[model samples]
Target: MIQVTPSIAIDESELEESFVRASGPGGQHVNKVSSAVQLKFDIRRSPSLPNDVAVRLMKLAGSRLTQDGVIVIVAQAQRSQKRNREEARERLLELIRAAAVRPQTRRPTKPTKASKERRLVSKDKRASIKAGRSKPGAD
Candidate 1:
């Protein structure tokens, strides 16, 4: 079982792992060994995640999520299949954990008087510099 939060634990069976040949580095072994791990998790089917978290996960997954609502993660950084598999699982957990929390809403704010003045001062300085760079007699 994979623990997402203090209360949330996902079954290992929920994750589907597949091995495939990894490109780059490993030369001869790259051709012979399937070291890359592809981890697929069906967010829509999983009862482990809350509906809100699943929705956020789907949006966070972007192109990684399929039409059927399965999230596909490919891990090929490691040379060994076991390491790649672990990496894939870790990545999925990280992605899920990130999506689990709702982001704080941004409060609309106007620039402070001093900050507005500073900005205008900077703009004036820039305009003056550009004005100074004008061709002779062109103003």
Candidate 2:
């Protein structure tokens, strides 16, 4: 089981991982060994996530989420399969944890009266300066 938050825990079975050969930096070993880990988790189908969290997760996943609502995380920074696998799992947990937090509601506010007055005052000052710069008889 993977614990994302205090209230949210996902079962190990919920995560699916596949291994593929990584393309860079390992020289001859890179072609021979499958060091990259592809981790997939279905946001829509997961029984472990709350509806609100799942919705937020989908939004947060963005391009990472497939058409079928599966989030695909590919980890290839590490040369070893185990390191890459762990990195993928950690990333998934971080994403789920981020989705668990509810966003603060934005409170709309009008500009202060003093601020509006200041803005109008500044505009008038600028207009006067420009007016003073023009030829006196050219009005």
Candidate 3:
């Protein structure tokens, strides 16, 4: 079981991993080895995540998410397959951890009287500078 949070623990079976060739300038060895890891997690069908969290996770996924509600994360920075696999899992865990947190709602705020005054003062100063740039006024 993969523990994401105190309340959320995902089963190993829930994750699907596939290995593919890592594309780049790595010469002949790179052509022979499939070091890249592709990690897929189905958010909509997950039993471990709450509905709200699942929704957020899908939104957070953005382009990484497929039409079927599966998140695909590719990790290929490492040359070793094991390292790439670990990186992919770490990234998924990070995403899950981020999705688990509740966002604080912003409260409506009124500008302070002092701040308002300061804004007006700055506006007046700018106006004066512009006014000074003009030619002498007609008598």
Backbone clash count for every predicted candidate, in the order shown: 0, 0, 0
Model 3, span 1-139: residue lDDT tens: 9999998999999999999999865678799999999999999888889999999899889999999999999999888899999999999999999999999999999999999999999999999998888889832
Q: For candidate 3, which ten residues in a row score worst on lDDT?
A: 130-139
User: Which pairs of residues clash in candidate 3, taking residues 3 or more apart in a chain or in different chains?
Assistant: none
Which candidate comes out best when scored by TM-score?
A: 2
Please state the error at residue 27 of candidate 3 in Å. 5.2
lDDT by residue (1-139, candidate 1, tens digit) is: 8998876679999999999999977989999999999999999999999999999999999999999999999999889999999999999999899888988999999999999999999999999999999999995
Question: How should the candidates be ordered by TM-score, best one leading?
Answer: 2, 3, 1
Better candidate by TM-score, 1 or 3: 3
Cα lDDT listed for each candidate: 0.93, 0.96, 0.93
TM-score of 3: 0.83
lDDT of 2 by residue, 19-100 (tens): 9999888999999999999999998889999999999999999999999999999999999999999999999999999999
What global local distance difference test value does model 2 have? Answer: 0.96
- Could you estimate the TM-score for every candidate? 0.76, 0.93, 0.83
lDDT, residue 4, candidate 2 = 83
Candidate 1 lDDT at 5 equals 81
